[model samples]
Target chain A: MNSLLVSLRVALATMLVCVGGYTAVILGVGVLTPDSAQGSLITRPDGTIIGSRLIAQKFDKPHYFWPRPSAPDYNASGAAGSNKSPTSADLTDRAKQTVERYGATQDKPLPADLAAASGGGLDPHITAHAALYQADRVAPARGVAREAIVALIERHTFSPGGPLTPDRLVNVLELNLALDRDFDPTSSSK
Target chain B: MTAMVFILLIVGGSALLSWPLGRYMKWAMDPDETAGPGRQKLDRIFASIAGTLGTEQQGWKRYMVALLIFNIVMFTVSFAFMALQQHLPLNPDEMKAVEGSLIFNTVASFTSNTNLQHYSGEASMSYLTQLCSLMWLQFVSAATGVAALAAMARGLAGRKMMGNFFVDVQRATFLVLLPISFVVATLFLFGGMPMTLQGSAHAATLEGLQQIIARGPVAAFVAIKQLGTNGGGFFGPNCTQPFENPTFWTNAVCMVAIILIPMASVWMFGRIIGRVRHAGVVFAVMLVFLLAKISGAVWFEQAPTQAFASLPIEQATGNLEGKELRFGAATVPLWAVLTTSTSNGSVGAMHDSLNPMTGLMPMIGMWLNATFGGVGVGMINMFIYIILAVFIAGMMVGRTPEYLNRRVEAREIKFAAVTLLAHAFFILVPTAVFAVTPWGAATLNNVGPHGFSEMLYEFSSAAANNGSGFEGLGDNTVPWNIATGIVMLLARFIPIILPLAIAGSLAAKKPTAQSAGTLGVEDVTFAAMLIATILVVGALTFFPAAALGPIVEHLKFMV
Candidate 1:
């Protein structure tokens, strides 16, 4: 009877320790708020609502802005990364194919990160170079003068030092929203 | 490529140094223990405590069960921690908790001594989550291993009042892991794994909007991850990041810490059983195998890959896949050798970057399960093989075999063979299945021979209970997560269970001293025989697969 009591006490003690420790961890990670999430709004052509700051959707009209690579399904809940290693041949070939599809010349140097997917596959921004490549095509579609679009870019481009070429980049999501209001009021991409 | 070289470098040092250091540690602790005053003091104190606690001596069978139960409890704790992370505190960034399917794999990986990682370190985990769920379990899992080590000592030393499970675990953590982890963890922090959950790196990308980069409390977790021989890194990049394993000293420290327990505990085992030279012999054979591989990796990586040279790309740099700038080519292989040899999956080099020939060393190491393995369990596992080697030699010579002063028999050998075959099966069958399947082929990070090598390396790592990968496998998929989890469970427990059962059964055996006809275990001949057993039986099994993978790659690059 005494032995049985000791065994029970030990088993109980083990269970309690495990439960207590486990609870501390669950509360530690699960309860935390996403306070750092940066929220932004999209204004439609008439200055009404659209969607989010980070999500990526299609830019259908051959005249609109393009978003960076995203693994998420337009910010769907079950969205996930392709889970491919950066060194994978499949990814390397895919990146190369994408570059070719963008009509980049064979000799043009591509940004390393541009060719590789982000670990989460939901990277929201592209280098100024990537944006600039699309700028020529996008400006012609909107009937906006090159200098005017470049000036809007100059105002919005972020840089720690003073003005620089790569520094005058624009956010795709924000830029697209601005395009909807400024011209093409009937644009439907949200 | 840089990380694989770092691994090569470490293997060079560990292979040359571990045996001598192991031998020295044996002599340093006690040259001729006529039973020192300190030993007596520890003994008396423990005995008194046991008496007061009303501890009853149980047979080895019951003790093994107790140890397994303790391990299961640890498993439960880690899993619960993962599930509950969402509601828990210390999440300053307020990151959402991990999903359950991912949580199951993560918990199993950490607890089973295989540290395979599938998630990003900074974004997915909170500070409270990192320390409590992952780091805390590292502590208990390491302690559970050492408790089993003490049980092995009892089996050999033939103690009537075998050591307490709780006491052994507490002592291992308090005396070994906690103190060492404090110092090592601090060093890793000094090397720049983050200690605080201060604001993450802030910036705007070329776009005017603010972009956030992932950073967190990695320094504290890194110490145990490396020291416990758990290679699952604090961040997704594993050890390649400057913050996680930064600088040369920290690199060396990580290497040293991974092998410390496995190396030092051999001396501890010798001391407990009163056979210093016996431990030295086992340590020596392991060193020879390790050193040869390290040199091979170093040589292999310095040579340029054939495909890279043939491509119009500049061929000056060697083996560049997934290689980080911080450590460069030489440092990668050094980290590789240490991680694989110690049951750690922590990688400094991208296994994808390794020269095809270079990948073989780690693949072989994981395939055989390092002779000295993860922390406490590693050294004990080596001893089980030594006993089996002795029994085999004795049977061949038509003599009764004795380890220390115990008879070897069919029952003991049966359990050891089960453990051996189970471990071996884990390495071979998994690699074969992956090789024939599209799931494995599609995940290939590099093409040709090295790709197959990386898949084999993953199985070798998982089955050996080492968690570090070649960083090549697309391990995030469901098949890998589930399959590797099962392998980790079986590989870890099977090795542990059989050794423990042997200990229990051996405790029942009456001591039978050696006669003229009986084989002598103490002499140099027996030592040579033991070395042969490890190299021939353990290593030879993986040779053909290695030839197909790393060896094939070597020939390709040369051609």
Candidate 2:
């Protein structure tokens, strides 16, 4: 019983120090860098919040670059992957449908990430190749030359700059926003 | 190619950092240190706060009692908090109280340092519950394991008493875990992870769709979640979530954080017992196994996903299903191996969508359960393997076994064997029961061998206290919650308690003088022996199950 009493005291003390003190410190320090601490939210010139730079937004329209397929439809309230095993028939059917949607064929296949659902369901970026693959569609819809779309993708493409860097990728949301600013699809030449 | 380089960087960077961190841990955990005036002041403050609890030196039995009682209190308090979350302060989203069984499971899971989540954090839990209850446990439970290891190391070093449990816990939390976590959390915040008390943000996307993006005290929660080997996520899909792990640099840092302290723990153990060379040998053995698993996972994932074979999409970039584009294929597999190897089960990619053979690598890590393992407990698990190795080697040479000048009798061997047996039994028996019954089959997200693998992986994770799962299993049901909750309890305490018992027993014996035939444990040959013992024991127990799941899945894919 004495041990139990001591245990209880220790537990409370530890919680106060950890949950109370430690969290207070982190939150306090977070005040200095409000932008990153507030989810790196992107805003319009009028200060209306659009989305986070880190988070994916749905972009099914032809004038925008598409992210990877999202199993939860980019629902941030609850994230999930398809959780399908490699041999599951559901996995195969979904992959095939994704390919068909992309107009992919044996002769001209889509980028792998373009045909797959991301684990988190909110992947913001797509491979540079995947972005370029959509150039034929995005350019026509925006009434811009294909070269202009290609050049825009190249400008937005970035790697973390190391031997350890993965493939250069473009943020789908950022690129599309830039497209609206630069190309102004509503005022198309066509 | 860049994937391999990143993996090597993570591994090599962790290994390099562990040395200095281990040295610091030695000074911080030592009870009798009169090192400096600064440390003396800190110790004095700790003593005043703890009163008798910090001052009293305990034997193994007393230490174990205090540890158990403390954990029980923590569990009870957190359970009540989670159960009544709707009424709690800071619940901005008006999250309801959790269901009874799930609350029990979540409490048990966190208390044991096995953070197997049945529910998604953003959807199910409020911010108050996430920080006060779950994140609090992440720090203390990890400290509990480290404290236990410290006690055992004291005993093995022939100290008169294991140091005070309360004191050690405080030191681990305040000195070791807190400082490191603060730096990591700040780094994560700058890397674009959110640290807000505001609920999910309402965003109007450029597509004019309303997107509810969840954000919370995630930076603080995730820092300890990785550093403590408590792999619970502030959101579902763990580090795969952009808010939790915002960039490739953050992902790489998370991978390093997962293994950093666990690797440091081996050096700390050696420091405690004054056996740094032996610790190096043990560290080497763990590194070899870890590297092999990493390589296997990376290599196996290079093959096109079998499910996509009939599709016209190009998979020449390797398996990309369930992988984030920024991290790409190689980093995902590398992260999977690293997470499982350290029992830090946070995933950058979904384990369910890994190629069949790549999926086997994490399982292999869990089955062994000692390749760097979980924080302090990893070293404790390795101690069991070392005991078994020493005994077998001694018996073959027609001599009694001795480790570090103390004899290893039947008492020690019996305890070690029971610990190992309990781990296997908890995993295999529960897996068998669940797989054949509605309890498992009804919950499967895949059919055939893959379904079996999911069940097997859950049990293996529970028993190893690994907490990573195949994620395809619908395991939030009563049976899974209750059974795995029970398994986590048993697997965690048994392995911990028995090792302490062995250490206590060894402490009682008088030390013998070192001789030429003291069984050189700090050499290449001993490492090989230790490796063989781990593999043979692990293979004998788990091979048939592996064959039934991933191996069969791989062969079927080939056909």
Candidate 3:
């Protein structure tokens, strides 16, 4: 009984130190890290808070650049992949759908990222190659030159190869948001 | 190639850093240190707790009892919180309470330091449960392993009594895990990882679709989870999830944290036994095994899948089917190897998507379970192998089987054999049971060898207390929950108990001077022999299972 009591006391004390004291200190530091510390929320020009800079958002319209396809229907509350194996029929169907949707041909290949859901199922970025491939479609819808759209893709393109992150990828959400903020077709036309 | 260098640097850096970390651990493990006048007040409180617990000086059995009581107390509290999560505070999402069997499995998994998560963290567990129960157990359970290792070290040194359990647990928590976790948590928080009590945020997607983004006190859980080798994730996608591992630096920090203490504990073992050379030999064996796993994973994962060979893009770019583009082929394989090597099961990429050979590497590591394994228990496992090796080598060469001047007798060998055999028994038996049963067959997400590998991996993970999954097993059912719960319990305690029993038996013997006929454990030849013993033991036990699952799968993939 004494041992159990002492164990309880120690457990409570350790919890106080770790959960209360330690977390309070670290959380204070987290809150100080700008918007990123709290889900990386970005604000639109209308003062409304949007999603994070990191998490992918749905961009299905022709004018907007699309992020990678999400499983669980882009529900952040339940972030998970299809977890389908290479030999899985569902995986094959999904890949086929993605290819047909993207209009890939023999000469012009779709980036693998476009055909596959990432492990997280919430990847914000797609390959630079994938991003550029959509330029023709996005350019016409936005009433922009192909050259300007390619430039925008280039600006948003991040090399995946890194001492940190290594690949040539573009953040789809940030690029689309930039397309709205910096390159308004209405103002350019006017 | 740069990814390989980065991984090598992290491993090399952590190994070098373990030297100083081991010194501090040495101080913490020493029971003879006086609190002194400057620390009288704090020391008195600790001393009182020790007194209350009757933890002054205990034989191994008494010590085990104390440890069990402590663990049971923690387990009970966590189980209660999980069972009553709906009524708990910090549950902003109004998540319901977990059912009985799942609660049982979850608590067992965490308490065993296995953390084989059957449920998604974000959608299932409330913030209160995540913090108070899940994160809380990760610390104590890991500290328990470190405490147990310290006790075993005491027995190895031939101490008449193993040190007080309360003191060992307290010191391991306060002196070792607490400080390191504090710094790591702070780094995560400041590095843009979320640490909020607010529920999921309502946000608009680029498509103007409304979505609720889940948020919680992730930074704190993420820190201890990795550092403790408690690989449970705060979110379903695990470390690969951006919120848990935001930047490249955080990913590196987490990767290094998993093996930090386990590697350090090896050095501490050599320090405790007063034989750096012996520890060096053991460390080398672990490294070779770890490197072999990494090479195999990287080699296979970088090749295009045989199923996808006809695709020109896949042939040109290698297998990107289930990998994060940011991590690419290079870091993903390294992460798989390191995570499994330490039994830190947090995944940065989908293991289910891996090629057959790539997926087998982590399984092989788990089967060995001592290639720089979990925080402290890993080195203890290696020590058990060393004991077995000594006994075998002595018998072969017509010498007296001795390690650290203690004779390797029948009782010691019995305990060691039980420990080794129990791992295989728990893994292979349960896997077989599941393979034949409709209940187990129902859980498989794939057919044939892939499905066989998934089941084998599940039991291997549970037995090894390595929690990463193939993610293809539909294992959230009641039978899986309860069955794995029981497996986790038996597999964890049996290995721990038998090893400690052997340590106790060894501690009671008087040290004899090394003679010409004594087996030299630190010799290079003995190191080679020990490596062979570990491999041969693993192969004899698990090779058939491996051949049935990964090897056959690989062969089929070739055609």
Candidate 4:
């Protein structure tokens, strides 16, 4: 009986320290870094909350760079991958359709990352190579030089230093926002 | 080339950190050791609190009872919080109460430190429950395992009494887990992981659509989730979620965090028993398995997924489906192996979308489980395998089995055998029953061998206290929740308690003087024996299931 009481006291005390104390400390520290603490929400010039720098947004228009295919249609609230098996016919059919949609020919193939769905469905970035592959469409649609669009992608390409880091990545939303800022694509195209 | 370098960095970085952290853990957990005035004050406070609760040195039976009772309290508290979460404060999203069986399953899951989630966190759980119930359980449950391990190590060291359970729990929580978690959580916050009580943020996209971007106190949750080997994510896709794991550096940090403590645990055990050389040999064997699995996973994932074989896309980048472009193909497979190997089952990519051979690597990790396994309990599991190896070697050499100068008689072997057998039994038996029933077959998101692999992986994860899943399994059903819940509970307590029992039995025996005939546990030959024992036992039990699932799937893909 004393053991049970001890167990209870131990559980409660541990909970207070771990859940209460630890969280309070982090939350307090979090206030100092408000931008990240509040989900890194990005705002427009007019101060409208546009999106997060981390989360992927849907972009199918020719003027903007598209992200990887999303199983949840880029639903941030319902993040998930397609979770398709390698041998599943449904998975194969979907991949084939994605390939067809990308208009990949023998000479000009889509990047594998572009043809595949991301794990979270809200993957914000694409490979720099994948972004470069779509330069022709984006450049024409935005009425910008192809070289300029490629240059924009290069400027946006990010690689956290080290051999362990993934290859250069370009955040699709950031590049599109940059396009709007420089080229005024919404006014120019639409 | 970069992939190989990445693997080496992660492994090497963890090994480097483990040594110093192991020494600190020894200092913190030791009853007689004090670092400074601060530690002495903290120790006095804990001692007084324990004194109020009757600070008697507990035997194995008493320790087990205290543990069971504490876990029951955890289960009850978590269940109440989850079930009544709708009525609780801090639920800014007004999330509803969880369903009956799911509540049971989740409570059992976190209480046992298995953390197998049947529901997505962003959609299903309230912030109150996430912090107060689930996250609370994550800390205490991991501390429970660490405390149990400390007691078991003391027993093996031939201490007349295992340390007081309450005091050990206090030390493990305050001294070890909390301090490390605070630092890691701070790092995660700086890496752009959200740490807020606010509801999911509303964002108007550039495409003029509303996206409810989920955010909460994730940085805090993820720190303990990885550090404690409790991989219950604050979001459904776990670390795959960008907000939870924002960048390559965060990805590297999470991967390193997953294995750091578990690696440190082997050295902690060595310090406890005063057997650093033996621990070094054991650590080397575990590292060998870990490197081998990492190599296999990375190699296998280099193949374009069979599903995309005929698609007119560049497959040279390897299986990119269900993988983040930011982390790429190499890091995902590495994370898969590391997470499973350590029983820290957070994923950077979907295991279900992995190439068959790649998927096999994680399964193999869970099957052998002791390749630098979960924080403290992993070392306990490895100890079970060591005893079995010792007994078999003893039989072969025509002498008595002894470890650390303690005789491993029939009782000890029986305890070890039961613990080993129970793990296989819990995993295989339910998988067999469920694979044929509506319970399992109805929930599968893939057909054929991949379908079977989902069920096998679920039970294996549950039984191994690994929470990572195929995720393709639509496993939020009542049957899955209930069945896996029971398996997690049994698998957790059996391995833990039985090892303690074995340690207790060994403690009662007089240390026999070592002779030339006695088996040397710290050398290469014993390493070979231990490796062989793990492979033979693990393979013998799970080979048929493996053949049916990933092996057959790989063959089919080849054809």
Candidate 5:
């Protein structure tokens, strides 16, 4: 009985060791990477800070690339999706909301994924096909000719191995950053 | 959708793998079975260094303590390696530091054969970090699995003490890892997996010359990662890499290699115990489940998903989203089932894209704790469950349970039962709540029954300590990250805890005399009874989730 109790203690010690180890590691990270009360502010070429990586801002403008739609929205730190079964009413409701959101985005209806999220709401890219649907609206909105817009869209399309649905896309975060770098506001539509 | 199905296939395929390997072990471990010259050299080395020091006759509690301490130390070191990777000598390109949370998950995951990865391989970690921290764990964890395998082998072999924990861990590493890794790694390198740290040539992205890409020492780690049944990747994109997974044949070979030793331990079981039929029964049972899930996935693949149904994608080629064109519907799940179902937790095909029902298959495998395996531990876990089942069958028949001189007494039965029930309790109760609750419901990525099923499946898989995801659960948040971490720890240890208790109690019990009323667990009757008990328990526990997830989702897609 004493040995059993001792064994129990040993197990508890082992568990504690694990817990303590993690706590220490976390503390180390806190010191090294130091949690910021504020997220790093990013900006357009205009020097105006837009937002932070920690925050998910809605990108509905035609000229800006879009991210995967989020449930509970794409913002809210540590926010997540409803773990609903495919047949549940909750999902249908959410989809309906997403569909409505998608409808407001452009003349064309939304891509299914455009209205949904990649499991980790942290997903940053939209599929090319989904991205291209926005090209028409963005081309005119930016006063860039449709052909030039098409060319930029073509430039962003990528295939890693041309395998596994080879259409996995340019991440929205990187793509938007590129837009800020290359797009010149002084260009005339004429 | 492709990711999810591949997960199921790999899981189910892993189960199928256990059988042949089990049968082979049965043949190989016999004293009468001739060791080829090479095997003799291998065996000799294990004998010398492993020292066979553990009193195969030591009492159970002591053995359990040794095993516990051994694993704890291993996890600690593995965790430290990740946390301290920047300081580690081997790190190339000064790999970025892994967040403690990711380290916590991988350490817990790999030790448990769960192999859950929160970070993308290339983006988050360096080659040195992958090798020392991730790859080292893969090797040692495989040893840990075989250690459990050997412990269970002790119970079956009718040893008095639970056997030497150190010997088992060492021999498993040497006897299994050294040779198996050689074959597997060589095959991978031959199959075009790269071992060098030279960055993959930067090429134009489909649209244009884009980001400077990173590829790593994939060949070396890819071999052990899968063959060791450690499912982490050289690159975060994982087995999705052409360099890592490569051609379909390479994927198949790697998949088979991972399960082969874990499954072979069963044959080792029969030989060590001098009972060929006993090993065969376990091997057979694992096969049945594997085949069932594999076929289920194939059938599901042939059917188009609603998401696809709404799209122009052809069903003939199967759902392509998140699937590697190299492996196709057939190979990915075969690889997936092999990886996730065995505690390998590695992914060659993205499980994020699987149709809800097809996706549920691997979830089922993980939820089962891949009882058929985590390389070494899978066979051991099933054996422990078998003991519990035998004890139950004996109770129902108004007799005592006796196997190889160990009495399956009331105490042993109680603890083992607690372990089984506790695991089920964890999976089912949480799943039921998630299905019913608003918070859980709001988390669904897909709508309809299929989406809800995925949510339940994700929690179940995590809670079960199986790391494969539906890729549907929007995890990485506080609620899930914390809940899952807790679940993974519990799922990994609780089963181990009760078994060790059972071993202790059995060690203390006097061998009961065999009589007409004593149940012979090795007979066809007992084996069949055991199988029925396992299925019923599994079916009863998981059927609701299965109905809500895979069964409902399958009908939705097919009908």
Candidate 6:
């Protein structure tokens, strides 16, 4: 009984210090962070919230760079992968369709990210190869020069270090937002 | 191919880092010794924390009671937070309360350091609950395991007075877990994983689609989640979600972090008991098993099964269906072995998607449970094996059983038996019960052998307190949540309680001088016997289950 009481007392005290005090410090530090602390909210000129830089948004329009296809649709409330077996007919059909839609030639097969769905249905970025492949289509549709679009993609391209240090990734949302700003300047604020 | 190189780098780096860190861990846990002036100052600081808590020297029973009560308190507080998360401040997502059964499971899971997340983190929890409740327990539960090991080690050294639990917890948290986590968290934050209190990041896709990106203070959680070997993720997809893992450097770091402490604890045991060579024998045994499992997993993962030959994609790039392209082939399987070997169950690739033979590696790793197991508990589990081996070897050689000169008698053997048998009982009995039940059958996403593997894997994971799963099982229902909750509680506490009690019993006895008839654990012959015993015991208990599940699944695919 004495030990239990001591145990309880010590536990309660530790909880107060570690859970209460330590958490408060972490929260304080979190608030001080530039973007993510506030949800990484991107805003328009009128201060209306647009979206977050971390999450992926739907970019179905031909004028924009497409994010990787999400499985079971991009429902944030219900995050899931398609969980398709490699041999599943559904997965194969979808991949084939995606490859054809992207106009893959004999010389260049569709990048895995382009033809396949990401584990998280809401992957925010696409492979540089996928981005480059779609640049030709996006430039002609948006009435922008192909070279200018490729350059824009290059600016937004991120190489996430390590062995993939040379392999670039383009955030579909960031590149799209930049497209809206460069091509249609008046609507950049809104 | 690059993944193989990265895996080598991480393994080599951790092995190099473990020597100094192991020495530091021994110094920190030992009350008598201080490294130098710098450590003396830190020791004084820790002493005050113990003073504030009124913690003094405790015997084994008193130490166990204190640890249990603290865990109980933590469990209750964490449950309350999950239940009332909606009303809590910092809930920008306005997430509602978790259901009653799930709250029990979640709290029990975290308290045991199992971290079997039934609910997706972002969808279910608020930032406050994640940080204060879940993350807090991650630190404490890890500290609890370390403390248990220290107390038990003191007993193994035949010390009458075990160290203070309060002092152990404080040092483990403030000194070890905190400093390491800070460096890793800083690395993650700089490396692109987002740190935010915001509910979710909303963005527009290039295809003019609106996407709500799930964002949280992931970097901080990810660091402790790996470093502490508490494998819960802030997202449902766990580390596979790009936001949680982000880049290759973070992924490599996370894998290294998973095995780092468990590896060190082996050497720490050596330092504590003043038996460095004995620790090396044990470390070599663990490394052999770990490397064997990793190699097997990698080989199976790289070769596409005949069943998958029908898929064009599998033919082109091996089995890339359930794996992230960023992690590559070798790292995915390496993560499987690393996570299971250390009881750090965070996965970068889908375990459920691996070939059946590859899937068996992790299950067997967990079954063995002593191959560099969880934090401090892993070493204790290894000690249990040591005791058992000593007893068995004594019988074989026709002499009295002794370990470190302490007599191994019936009571010690019984305790060790209970600890080993408890894992099989909790795992097998529940699996059988679930296999017959309609609820358990309903949760399976695959049928036949694969379905059986999924159910078996759930109970195995729970019993081992290694929380990675088959992922296809719909385990959010009342039965899974409650049953696994109970299994986790019993498996975690029973092993801990029994081992400490045995250690206490052993500690009370006077050490006898080693006779010519005595068996030393440091002998290569003894090490071989120990390895054979582990393999035979594991194979006998689990081979049937494996045959029914992954082994048979592998056979069917082969034919």
Off by over 4 Å in 4: B33-38
For candidate 3, write residues B1-559 as lDDT tens digits.
5767777887788888888888778767663445345444444566566666544787899889889998998899999989999987889999897888889999999999999999898899999899889998998899899988888888898886887788778778777888998889888877778988888888866566897888888888899999889999999889867788776677778878888898989888887777888888899999889888888888887666444333323355566656666655577788888888887888888788787888899998898899999888999888889988998898899877998999989999988988899899888998999999976899887778888888899998999998988887898889889888998888777877888899899888888898777778788888888988998887578999999988898787644
By DockQ, the best candidate is 4
Per-residue error for B48 in candidate 4, Å, reads: 2.5
> For model 5, how big is the iRMS in angstroms?
12.2
TM-score between candidate 3 chain A and the true chain A: 0.91
- lDDT string for model 2 (A20-138, tens) is 88888889889988998988899988988899988998988788888889999989788898888867889888877788777888888888888788889999999888899999888
The i-RMS of every model, in angstroms, reads 10.1, 1.4, 2.1, 1.4, 12.2, 3.8
TM-score (second chain) of model 5: 0.86
lDDT of 5 by residue, B174-259 (tens): 44565556666666655555454443333222122222334455655676777676776665446654445655557767777766
lDDT of 1 by residue, A69-147 (tens): 4443323212234333323356545655646545554354333333433323333444455566666666777777766
The DockQ values of the predictions, listed in order, are 0.04, 0.74, 0.57, 0.76, 0.05, 0.28
In candidate 4 the C-alpha lDDT for residue B477 amounts to: 94
lDDT of 6 by residue, B386-504 (tens): 88888888899888799888999999999999899999999888998999998789898777787888889889899989998888789999999999999999988998999999989
Candidate 3 lDDT over A93-148, as tens digits, reads 66667767877766776666777677777787888888888998888888878999
TM-score of model 5's chain A: 0.61
C-alpha TM-score for every candidate: 0.72, 0.98, 0.96, 0.98, 0.69, 0.90
Runs off by more than 4 Å, candidate 1: A1-190, B1-56, B205-210, B312-316, B437-451, B516-518
Preferred candidate (TM-score higher): 3 or 6: 3
The lDDT per prediction is 0.61, 0.88, 0.82, 0.89, 0.58, 0.78
Using alpha carbons, what is the TM-score of model 1?
0.72
Point out the higher-scoring one by TM-score: 1 or 4: 4
Query: How many backbone overlaps does candidate 1 show?
Result: 48
RMSD (Å) per prediction: 9.7, 1.4, 2.2, 1.4, 10.0, 3.6
Candidate 6: segments with Cα more than 4 A from true spot: A20-33, A36-54, A62-65, A84-110, A129-159, A163-170, A174-190, B33-55, B204-208, B304-314
